[model samples]
Target: MSATQSHRGVGSAVALPPLSNGPHRKRLGLVALIATFGGLLFGYDTGVINGALRPMTAELGLTPFTEGIVASSLVFAAAIGALSGGRISDGWGRRKTIILLAVLFFAGTLVCVFTPSVGVLVVGRVLLGLAVGGASAVVPVFLAEMAPFEIRGSLAGRNELMIVVGQLAAFVVNAIIGIVWGDVPGVWRIMLAVCALPAIALFFGMLRVPESPRWLVEKGRHDEALAVLRSVRSEDRALAELGEVENVAKEERESQQIGWRAVFSNKNLFRILLVGIGLGVAQQLTGINSIMYYGQTVLVESGFNESGALIANIAPGVIAVIGGVIALTLMDRIDRRKTFILGLALTTSCHLLIGFASMMLPVGNPIRPFVILFLVVAFVGSMQTFLNVAVWVYLSEVFPLHMRGFGTGVSIFFLWVVNGFLSLFFPSLVAGLGITGTFFLFAVVGALALVFVVKQVPETRGRTLEALEEDVTTGAIYLVHKNQG
Candidate 1:
């Protein structure tokens, strides 16, 4: 293949053939749309708490400690969900696991919307958290497995976009509800209730989509895998791709190291697992979720009144959507490593600026809140554009098929764990350290994240999953760095 053709595949020597302008393309688009509803739910469920928490706190007479427990419970449960979801999807099939998650989303939403006490709310949140974490682990992998390598990044990235869109939707819904019914008791329940509609949609929508072809091949179901592939790919491409996948699956099976054992027995697999965990941890430590879960609190501390802060929280949600759109456009055009490097750098700079602005402006300054808000918005934009979508897509791609579910689950488990702890203690951190000290702490962490990316992250763009798998399993991916030096 010429360089031009191969560039479409990012860096692969073998270029994929042009997709047929057939119904298969439309089918692929439909599948992506339906599957991304899982992401939408993930976003809405997580972000709704940003605005709803205060109202719920008032209704239930929650203390800061109880509020933290209510908020962190879902996140902590999600950590468990991510771990189990991966294993379940690996055994139960991706499509089926998603369907199960849809059920969980619905059940959890009901629990939250109707719960009379904090205890019941915590129970609800845990259910929702499981669904959210499962979606986090499974959705991107499902998308990647369904897509051709040529446009895999964008395809997989659509879930992240949906996630942000869902978050934006939550912010918008929360603002409208809070503003329109500011005096109404239990209005936060309405905010949570909105999540149930999408859960219903995802359940029915997933029923119409085919299972992941790569996953089917992994289970030795060649005919079924081919059928699924044919629905999304052209006739010749489906056959060829199936053959390639089968070859890789055969090699994986013959090696006889699967799941955690594969990771432990093979040095390369273990290294990749560590890399996956590192990426997940690094992404969370950037403090993005701290804002997502508690933007209203941050804004109030910065200087905005409660209502104004509720409204202003929408700004980050809006920019996040915009950034996600731009990221989807760039996913195929830019290399994954470059995106990580740039995202970390931009986010770190924004964190430092936010800290310094808070310090210089102080509490009484008229412009302190606006300046801080603008910096927070900038930080979110940088994260969505450069890191969030890219990290999810890369995690979905890096693991070999045999261990993909386990690997992604384990990695995102840590991601959610870190996120849960941060969400739990962020309010306390800010109360103790104030905005300047808190953000300065984030800045320090962001700087360290940058170093980790530059040192350890590898380029995965422009390669087939199977090709990438070969490189990852054999440790040849590390050679790229050595060769560059």
Candidate 2:
């Protein structure tokens, strides 16, 4: 059968036009929003600890090293979750994978909220970390697969925006909870429990959402896949998409091997995997997580009282959300490479300024908190505006469709592993070198990342996933080979 004929008649049914109307758009948005609640839980579980940690440490008698362990335990678990979530999503389908994540989210938070010992707390955090890792990997892929190519960036971009919104929500909640019941014996429990609400919402909402059509095609449920496609897209467009998806799924099946080993054996796939991992690692090195997980601590160390630091910590969250809003508007217009380079440059400058100010400000000086706080906010703004959305979008889009899930999972696993170590050792780094020394290290990493982004990253702002996959998998993107071929 010809390509056009096969697409026009799927098995035996006539191809219908794609749906592009109110009901379909609303359903798509609702699904995206539900999956994003996992991001919200991720942000809150991680960010709430920033403010809650001080009081929790006092109550639980944690040492600096132990503090690092406690904070990083979740991140380490998340690495495992990220590594595994992709394979699971591939096997189980995106909707079911996320529904499972919701269960983990609720259960993990419940354990953390009531834990009496540090060991138990660590266990709970590890569980939460797994959920976070899964959410981070699956949410973007699910959105990218479901969204139309024209709005794919914005729709997939929405998950990252939701993550920051979740982080901001955590910050605001911490501030309010810390102030209203400041002297309560277990105030941090309240901060942690707040995530339960979102977790429940995610699980219930996902029960009603449709499974990803791509997953259906991969599983050889072609008619069901076409039905799903028809729900969101016009019938003709949906059939066209399903045909393309079916073709790629067939290619993947013929390849018959998909894993880290296959990815490494193909030198070009290796390069793409490296780029994905590099982007994840680079995104973390910007030190944005430091703020989310320890913003209040950083502010206090900069010389503010508990009350003042709690209040001041909200600034970055506010700016981050605003930057995210701007990013949504600009994502379609901007080049991915340029936005990434710009983010690295701006964030690197912020790190240097922060480190310099910390060194220049004498202990007990009034200006120190204000200066460091401003710089921190600047860093968050730069990251939210440029790197966060682009990194996730690129990682999701850069790989051949055959390896998208496994590749993203591997890259994100290493990404979270690096983040785990950083979170674990950050306080020690601060203790040994002070804030100036700490941020100075970030500045060095940022400079290296900027060089990597400008020289190696590809532009992916306005291409369909099929187009991108074809270009990327064939080595068409590298300038040296494009004309030679």
Candidate 3:
């Protein structure tokens, strides 16, 4: 599968033949790398707290109640961030909006690092949360718009890959710091500081990247859109894609106005939006994030001591990174529907396995913690490889260009809300029900989520975003694509 290369004016809307390789791929890769720094910061900011929370709790004199509040503040803020980010990107353009998010990320990190009181820390977390939520919604959409259809899945999925990589880095950093400076009073501040580097990186990196070409077309800057597409796409493909964008834009202009009213009034658009919402909500229901946020707690409850659990919590993060790599490889090759169905199947089974293991094994038994951890790691791997990338990519591509940002924002806002609720209540759930009851509940919810995907989710695997928009608006995208093999 070599991509054919040509040196031609990308700014001209001329049709060209398809081939793999060359400068176009390089430019696209560079753009993806830069844009995905947002994902790295998102991952780092969110995961840093997983290990930092214990130290932060001690330093802040937090109770279990205050601990939940501290931990969930960012998540609650993220919900608002997702909604506002969507509107900002739609109004201000994705590239510039990311630049603003970088500033917020930097400022928020400083606030958390320098804060003397819990109230100040909460304010800081909310600011950081806005950046995280914005990144989560915008990065994938930005990449999706930039990438050629042939490889859009893998390229867009890079954001998820970077996210897990960021988590892995946090885990490693926390482990090293925890081992060496186990008694340090302000170790959490150092953990929070690591996020600032990526924030600075993203702020500068985006300067070199072009705005989304489709977005330019949406805003009536067709010439600038062509220039951007030319830099990253072959002359022929750029023209073809730009033509598609024009047609869609023309259709949108003729048919309806785009906003909250259009989204709710149009049945097709509303249905697709509901699908995005379902995917967002269903992904979080798997309990993957609970492990991400509180891996140490789960491990300690299973059997390991505090120190052992802190160090041991890195296992899931490692598996998450590995699984993300595998997912990127599979993204363009596999059907979206298959990935979701298989992921939910594996994760659901892992949940059941964890619950049963906890029920059967006594806490004093040495094998108990290891078995539960094994299942948790397996679940995380299944999720990263199959579900996370698929869901994010699908949401980014499913909406019409007019509503892409708004639709994804609304969907992810709910996703963050679910994430916040779980982050807040998970400790209580664990403390009250123990591992068995908690996991069984996840298994039940996962089973239901699997059913939803099997029934309602559409296949977006080989289609261009414009083609997808066409099918989705006509409500023809719900059918599954079967392989000729």
Name the top TM-score candidate. Answer: 1
Ranking 1 against 3 by TM-score, winner: 1
Error of 1 at 274 (Å): 0.6
TM-score of model 2 vs. true structure = 0.93
Model 1 lDDT on a 0 to 1 scale: 0.92
C-alpha RMSD for every candidate:
2.0, 4.4, 3.9
Query: What value of lDDT does candidate 3 attain over all alpha carbons?
Result: 0.88
Q: Per-residue lDDT of 288-402 in model 1, one digit per residue for the tens?
A: 9999999999999999999999999999999999999999999988999899999999999999999899989979799999999999999999999999999999999999998
lDDT of each: 0.92, 0.83, 0.88
Distance from true location, Cα of 118 in model 2, Å: 0.4
Off by over 4 Å in 3: 1-16, 479-485
Candidate ranking under TM-score, highest first, comes to 1, 3, 2
For model 3, residues 12-55, the per-residue Cα lDDT tens digits are 23233584577988988899999999999888888888899999
lDDT of 2 at 50: 86
Q: Where does the lowest 10-residue lDDT sum fall in candidate 1? A: 1-10
Alpha-carbon TM-score of each model against the true structure: 0.97, 0.93, 0.95
Candidate 2 regions off by >4 Å?
1-19, 255-261, 480-485
Where does candidate 3 clash, by residue pair? 2-20, 3-19, 3-20, 3-21, 4-19, 4-20, 10-230, 15-236, 16-236
lDDT computed for candidate 2: 0.83
In terms of lDDT, the best-performing candidate is: 1
